[model samples]
Target: MDHDIEKAPSAPPTRRDALRVAAGLLAVGAVPLAAHPAAAYPGDIDVCTGGYDAEYEADLAMAEALFEAEEHRAFAPERPPGRYTLPLRRGFRVSARYGIRGDWLAGHHTGIDLAVPTGTPVYAVSAGVVVLARRSGQYGKAVTVRMRDGHYAVFAHLSRIKVRQGARIRAGARIGSSGATGRATGPHLHLEIRARRGYGSDIDPVRYLARRGAPLL
Candidate 1:
């Protein structure tokens, strides 16, 4: 008697197994010359693998180059230390801060009010040119310094102004003496940091100084 035997078929190949086969075939140059020209172009070859696509390869290379350059490049240095200093050195108290809403002020306090003596020396926060040094309306004897950083430093309510208009001064140089020359409750320094050298361009003076490494506590 003759017996018939049945055989089990092999399992389907995984994607990885197919890739390996394809890679092996490629290694031996199994790809036919009749294949697409793009696949055979040298520029289409991947930097990491045998993948094809000239645009993709170029973009990948460019991305890698950019990343490498950024990793090794030196970052921009921060502003030098001691480049800025407080307008007042010591023995002063903050009577009023910026943005205080009151009926007396035009909507809000444009700058800070440091309660100091009538003749406390006020210095330039940074190297700058004096743009205004005269009786500036409600500001009284004010000195507006066009600072090196482009922001205008307005020292308002001053009793004495030492700097003249268009005069270049160094950082920490005495600009005037603080007093209640303008609208104020008592003898104090009204400091305003303005984007322009006029009224209504006021920014927070304390915050600006703090950013330049000078803080008023």
Candidate 2:
């Protein structure tokens, strides 16, 4: 008895076959997670749609979770208090001072500009509550801390803000780093001592800091 078996030719690969292959590769760690191009989706990716890959949908979810974790780190938690210190220690040279300036909108510069290089650590002048820590219009990445004296200490033109609003940071704590993030010609820290919490209430920050024993000279 001679029984010959003729095997059927292999069918062409479908979309599902390709997806399964990708899933298997991902599961076995053959491909790095960073290789997945999953940043396109701002929300959920519909896996119910035909030909959609489940692994890809999962990649998007992982990327979003990572983003949230990083963001949480940026906004630091509340900390204990310490003594007062100047915004800058070494690069304390004042490039601009508070007073009438024709180039300014208020016909005056509301803050003193410290000519520090980009990424210089700017510390808190005194222990206070951070009222504003976000990307302001012309100030760029700014952080305004309401000091114990009720005056606002404004740190503007920063490259990065380390504290969040309502966080009670200590005196001399690193609030942010200096940069030309706002309307500025170069890297500097725009420091303002305000009588009130508004724009037009600025006073001479150098004299103010000196009186408080945290001289910026």
Candidate 3:
């Protein structure tokens, strides 16, 4: 998440040297042939007047402007929203609802836990591209599908993954099998709905899928 600019070597002090030369001219009351309007000020006044190095300042200004432009360009737009289907057919009973329990060390659960036996077939909830298919940390054997609506549907604690990353899958497509792959007491499917774009909100999966015409037990 760290996004910072790398430091670059600074240019030589051409403006400071020029200002010094200009000051010597005005002190001796001798105007140099190279004297410009900026060097016409009396007694090193350019040093204190903030007009000493016009070119140097201009270069610094341009560099700073370009840096800002690059910074903005580095920030990409948020992903667009897309329609999603239920990852499983004939939803199983909800063993644990989202944000209902405080017993977990992570506080409220961000996803719904569907009670299912080990090796139970789990399908893709919607038409989306498989973004994640791996096993790690607490979400063992996880699969993340990014729908066209920019939302992501995650199925965790899977026993096996049937699809690979970057694969386009349709609704109800077999993506994995449910199991107690992560830290859990029994086999179940951990389902999550994450908002697309920069909105990292975790929505209620039951209510969300129900609105999409998917039955929820």
Candidate 4:
């Protein structure tokens, strides 16, 4: 996912160049962009509706069971305590869920996993103050937001942190980019909605997000 973006040339395209262009577009889910000239690619086949490419889908499945390990902790679960949008845009395909699964979580899986590209933009699920923004141990580069409800939200395995601690941020604000960090086996965002601003006190973020209008499974 880490690539050096280069300026594309406007010269006459070769067959190989055309295929590369088409592939790049498809991988980004923007193949046959309306703004692109139909004849730009070889064979003049105008791709429509962003056709699915097998490689792209497989490469982008949520990172290795959403990067989890056991953490036996107790929770005084509560409702969302507020509204929220999908932590990742375009809805989700949750790779890992809340609660203990003998496979991933030890006692309780605090958050839900939304596997995505390494540099996919991550938005703040709700308005809150950035309380913690640092390289947390197994969580990698993480951000903890103190929501207006006093409950907390965690965004982990980030490639870059976009906001600073103490910053008052609103829902949908760009907070960070997803990545394969900490104990992750692949690139994805580890999202947790907690009863407070720490581990060992987590709730079902899936149900919480759903109640808030974003139903993800």
Candidate 5:
């Protein structure tokens, strides 16, 4: 007589079995694991933490370097000389003389005004040091020429400055262009002869220049 063999019965999956299957599938879908720990972290966290491999880190470093370079560039101070030439050639017509406009806020016109075109070439009246060559709210673009006589000749309302500060200049040299700058009513040069003491006293430029052989027109 022969004996019969029995087959094992299949069992249905439980909740645990289903969960294990889902996890396996998820692991497979997330393939290509990163080699670095920073890559494993969230991108935003890496950036905020200054991660070297972060996308914007290089750009930030470059910007910082550029800013530093620009800061150093301005570190070199501008050294203007102590003197400059009188920025006018021939004698200019006087439109307003210094000390005559005392009613103006400037207390008094510390300089004489020369009537000229918008961009007339202004030459150095006398040779001296360029004590000042810069812009002022009232003087506009001005140049202060210190003469050998210990007096300061101020030329105001210029369009441009040709020489740098600290550079030596001769008489009749082109220093700047005439213009209506700094509280000017029109295109004119405000000239003033200040006695080294400052604004307290100023001599009449008209008679002074005339005596110096600058004929008044």
Candidate 6:
């Protein structure tokens, strides 16, 4: 009674086996699998294309919003009444009102004329930067300060000019002495509050000052 055992047949190589073979071939410097075509890869982006732009736009929007907020704070909403003062320290009279017809101006008086003594110290009505401090034709030695409320405070007919263009001025700070430097019958300080930069944008100076609890005639 002799017994003989029959051996099972070996399995064929699988996909895993083929992959392993390919890897082995590659390790051994085989060019067959190494030269196989593959889909192109774009490597320029540090992050996902959509993701980077979203973050960038979010940051830019945040910055713009912050700037707008700051600009609004700097120049919007009229300041409270009593926020300004009389340009002169002592007795002065409002000889003329805004919109009064005058030959000095093109057609009207653009501001209130305060008839103060000659050489009287003139002060800035509010904290601002001087945009104009020079000799003007009719304004004489003028000084115009741009206020925080986005309005302009123009002081004209100065005997002398103190601040220059681009100078920072404080509220009630002395700018110059008042006089009838240009065409005038008497010594006075001409004050104008414009909504914008120049004469065409001129608004009422007397009412504007009176509402602010300043000295009014």
C-alpha lDDT score of every prediction, in listed order: 0.60, 0.61, 0.58, 0.57, 0.51, 0.59
lDDT string, candidate 4, 75-164, tens digits: 222234355766677544455556633322224455766767788899888876665676755677878776666677888888899997
Which tens-of-lDDT digit does each residue in 1-217 have in candidate 2?
A: 1112233455554545545644553454332222222222123221111112233224422332333232232222223323568888674556666663433334466677777788899999988767667775556788878676667788888899999865767788899999887556668888878875434567998788787677777
Could you say which candidate leads in TM-score? 2
Lowest lDDT sum, 10 consecutive residues, model 5, at 43-52
Which regions of candidate 5 fall more than 4 Å away from where they truly are?
Answer: 1-93, 104-108
In angstroms, how far off is 154's CA in candidate 3?
0.6
Off by over 4 Å in 3: 1-84, 103-106, 197-200
Model 1 accuracy (lDDT, Cα): 0.60
Off-target runs (Cα >4 Å) in candidate 4 are 1-83, 103-106
**How does each model score on TM-score?**
0.60, 0.60, 0.58, 0.59, 0.54, 0.59
RMSD to the true structure for each prediction, in A, is 31.8, 23.3, 25.3, 20.5, 35.0, 33.6
Error in Å for residue 123 of model 2: 0.2
Q: Give the TM-score of candidate 3.
A: 0.58
Runs of candidate 1 with Cα error greater than 4 angstroms are 1-82, 104-106
Candidate 2 lDDT trough over 10 residues, lowest sum: 44-53
Stretches > 4 Å off in candidate 6: 1-82, 103-106
Least accurate 10 contiguous residues by lDDT in model 4: 64-73
Cα lDDT tens digits, model 1, 76-156, are 212332378999987887766677654322345677778788888999998765655777445667777666555778787
lDDT-wise, the better of 1 and 2 is 2
TM-score, predicted candidate 6 vs. hidden true structure? 0.59
How many pairs of residues collide in model 6? 1
Clashes of each: 0, 0, 10, 2, 22, 1
